[model samples]
Structures are given as structure tokens and as C-alpha cells.
Target: MPYTTAPVLPPGTLSRSPQPVLPTGDGLVLRPWRGRDVAAVHEAFQDPLMHQWHIRRSDSEAEVAGWIEGWEKEWEGERDAQWAVVDADSDRLLGRVALRSIHLVDGLAKVAYWTTAAARGQGVATRATATLTRWAFEEIGFHRLELLHAVANEPSCRVAEKAGFALEGVKRSAALHQDGWHDMHLHGRVRGD
Candidate 1:
């Protein structure tokens, strides 16, 4: 049956404005992806760890550019919101952060992110996630956000906690990595959490 009440977020919520640049209030910022970032994204995908965790990898700069283009299209469609996490001082691409699988009526989305090999362990993911969460809830009027990562991904789990997501449970054999099916850890944060 259709919802009897109003959507948690209105239809035009995301599309009303251009994608925003969010500040980490530390040393990083989440900005809209640029065409120039193709090379850096390609390099990030080259890391074996990125390949092991993410099912797909950018095979070439062309593919990465296409991915960035898709991000813009998805943003307009209100299905996804993507940002390139960059260094505040240098504007170097450090990673990416995104809200995927967005559901406007439900006010829910899946949080996703990745940091470069050199940026890992520097709290880049955590900072970006936290900054994005605040924007999602405060500005976009989302009610909840969920983050899921492979069970073996300890660093991601830590980032979730640091970004204020609670460990909800595990989804057994939820994701297929290059190696095989892997259990996934599910974490979530609701408004006011």
C-alpha cells in the first residue's frame, strides 16, 4: 500500500540545490567530484585493498571519468550523492564519500566511502563520514543512514563507530568479494544519534 503520510523528505530536497561542499572542520573537505580527479581515482582503484573490498574497480581513467559523470547524473536523479574528499590546503584527492541507494520518502540512504592508501589511518574516512552525516541529517532532512562493510573490514567498522554509527548486526554472506561471499557488518545512525 502507498504511504498514508508525507515522505520523510520531500521530492525536491536534493535537487533543489547544487551538490554542496562540506567541511570537516579539521583538514579535509568533501567537494563535488571533478573531471580532473579521474587519474587519482584510477590510482586509488589500483590498490589491491580497494579491489578486495569493492566489487568493481576502475579499469582506466576513462572509466573513472564515466563514474564521475554518473555521479553527477545520480545526484540530479536524487538516487545518490557523491563527493571527493580532498585536502583543504592542497586540494589533493584523498578519497571519496557518498550516500548511495537514497530513498527520499523513507529518508534513508547507505553511506559509502574509501580513503587513499596514503590517507588511510589518518581519520580521513571518519571525518568525511561525520561531516556527511551532519549534512544528511541537518540539511537534507534524512531520518536515518546505514553503513555496511565486509565483516573482515576492521578499519571500516572503526570509521563507522567514530562517525557515530552504531553496530546493529551482521548480514551473513551478504557481499561477494573477489575472493568469495563475505559476511557484512551493518551499522546505523538515526537523527539525533
Candidate 2:
């Protein structure tokens, strides 16, 4: 069976950010994930909800190290970028955000994020999502940004909506969760440029 593809942004339309930005809002700082963030990332992944919804591998120190290394490689290759969410004052990592699955040829990218359990409902994810989306569209010149969430993840859907992403639709049986085939919601925002 053939799959339908989402609309792509124009070629050579999106550009990379000239420099790393430290976006701050709502007392949170969104900046590049660093090696020092490994412990925080590991701790955040320990949350049951995080493990249930997003964790695909065992949350070991080695795994966290490898994950940080992977982000470094992506940054070096200019294929993708990730950021660690932290308290603006203390610089304590609250979570992570990333623009992954980047398609420079298509001027499109997807945003993925998660916050520590303690940080939920405090607008951390919402603010981070909005800030990152704006940076992706304006600074990076990405014309299209997409976000996907399992149908059961209501909080995630809320975050996407709050970030100005329109609900494109659902892909039936688009994801296979531990329970079974599950529907996934696709949300997107197109740059005015």
C-alpha cells in the first residue's frame, strides 16, 4: 500500500541558526543539551509516565551517555539539534527539547520534547515548544514544523496546541505501542515566510 506524504516546504528554504541561542521564558532556559545534562536526563526518564510514553531503552548511565553523544554527533553533522530545558536562574535541567527528523531539502522538521514530572503543568513544555518553534521558523528558516503524539497523550497534545500547531489529523494505527496499534495525532505549523 502506498503512503500519503505530508506537504513539504520549498527546497533550500530553511537555514540553520547562525549561532546557538539561549531562549528564556517563564523562568526556563532553552539551550543546547550538554554532557552535564546526562544525570538530569536520566532522572527525568525515570518518571513512570516518561518511561511509558517515550523511553525505548533501559535508563542506564551508559544509555544516557550514549544519548548525549548521539545529540553531539547530530549537532556536529548539522542534521539535527537538541536543547536542554533548565531553570533560568539556577540552570537546573528541567527536561529536553529537540528538532529532529530534519529535512533541509524540504525545509521541514519535527519537534519533540519532554519535561520532568515535577515540571509538568507549570508551562515548561508549552513555553519551550513555543520558543523552539519560533526559533526553528525564524532563526533557522524552517517553513514547516510538525509534532506527533500518541492519541492517549493529552498533555502532549495540549502543549502542541498551545504552541500554535494546528491539528492536521490522525493516522490510524500509525504507532505500535506496547498495548497494541494506536492512533497518532499529527500537528503542524507553517511559517508565514
Best by lDDT: 1
What is the lDDT, from 0 to 100, of the residue 76 in candidate 1? 87
- Clashing residue pairs found in predicted model 2: none
Best by TM-score: 1
lDDT of each: 0.94, 0.79
Instruction: List, residue by residue over 33-123, the lDDT tens digit for candidate 2.
Output: 6788878888887777876677364558789989888876676555677888899889898878888888775677889998888888898
The TM-score of candidate 1 is 0.98
TM-score of each: 0.98, 0.87
lDDT, model 2: 0.79
lDDT, model 1, position 55: 92
Task: For model 1, state the Cα shift of residue 48 in Å.
Answer: 0.5
Q: Where does candidate 2 stray beyond 4 Å?
A: 1-19
Candidate 1 segments exceeding 4 Å error: none
